[model samples]
Target: MGPAPTVHAESVDFVMLYIVAISVVLLIGITVTMIYFVFKYNRKKGHEPVDIHGNVLLEVVWIVIPTLLVLSMFYFGYTSFRELRDKPDNPFIVKVTARMWQFTFEYANGKKTDTLYVPLNAPVDLEMKSVDVNHCLYIPAFRIKEDIIYGQTNHLYFNAKQTGDYDIACAEYCGLNHSAMYTKVKVLLDNDFTKWYGGNWQPVKNGSASN
Candidate 1:
């Protein structure tokens, strides 16, 4: 048997690192400030709390700093999302249909199925919509997730750089079987994918087939 695909695992790791770093810095800063204030103004330590409340300059500084920080975060997040969703010059277009407890993927050649398959190192544009209730097309490995709203189409794009099996789950609560609404994405090397699609080769259960 061939080896399972690696999917977009690296992207997930990068995103996780970014989140962790941001969280750690914020936590440490808050913790240090809290501890410093507690020790500096302790009653038993021959210190008294200064009750100089409502300093305009301090209030303005706190408000402006937090506002700027939040806006910066928002800008970065929006740019990241824009880059992820924008269609590349020539992407492999795929149609995705989300249902109550399953997802159906359709290739450009009119083939349709539950599983998602794509060529590695290629950009893929997912034109997705919901068939029944609202659902989300979530590929954690790619750091991409978009809602598949009923009666409306949503799109997402990603370049799969690795070959592996990746999980696809609904990020929104659609129905009873929301937990079971999942699928797998298989990223195949370019040449191997061509051979597989052309009937010249088949993917083995546990082997690496390079492009």
Candidate 2:
């Protein structure tokens, strides 16, 4: 079908759009203000540089406006980040281990694969650890990325809404073949995943065919 959907899709979109909107507004405002000041106080126009003390009202306006804007941005970003950090209850948990240049996923049923297989629309918790150096599991489609440490357990969650194969890669630079330290996350339909989980395992071809 189409691309696999992640639970963080909307949140990511919101955060990105919010940041972009603010950036665009600020960019335009600052650019226009600079241009206006350039022409309004041009040296060629015989205007001398005025070294007057700054007006308290202008200073307060600038400070308060930017402070409010920054606070609002922080609020939105923190809210979105909090949603990503809050783990779901009783999710389909998978333990992920990163070693050298390979990735492994182990399920509760003892089923393991180099590729992560998750059920569509179901919350999946990835409990991750690194065997050697530090690594980060980055799934761009799910907007889920977390650092994996040798002595610590790092986790992230996602819920795929569609069946498809998404790319997974290590965001951290481990060593040689760090670029090759990549894999796929195959999102399957609920029924298909159930069958596979129950040991009636079959390959999913073209993301639609289970054979």
Tens digits of per-residue lDDT for model 2, 122-211: 677899988899999998887779999889998888878778999999999999999999999999887888887886433232343433
Cα lDDT of model 1 by residue, 54-145, tens digit: 88998999799878876766665566656675555556778999888999988766778788988787778899988799999998777678
Question: What value of lDDT does candidate 1 attain over all alpha carbons?
Answer: 0.75
Identify the candidate with maximal TM-score.
2
lDDT to native, each model: 0.75, 0.83
Off by over 4 Å in 1: 1-23, 46-49, 199-211
lDDT accuracy of residue 26 in candidate 1: 83
Which residue pairs clash in candidate 2?
none
> Worst 10-residue stretch by lDDT in candidate 1?
202-211
- TM-scores for every candidate against the unseen true structure: 0.78, 0.88
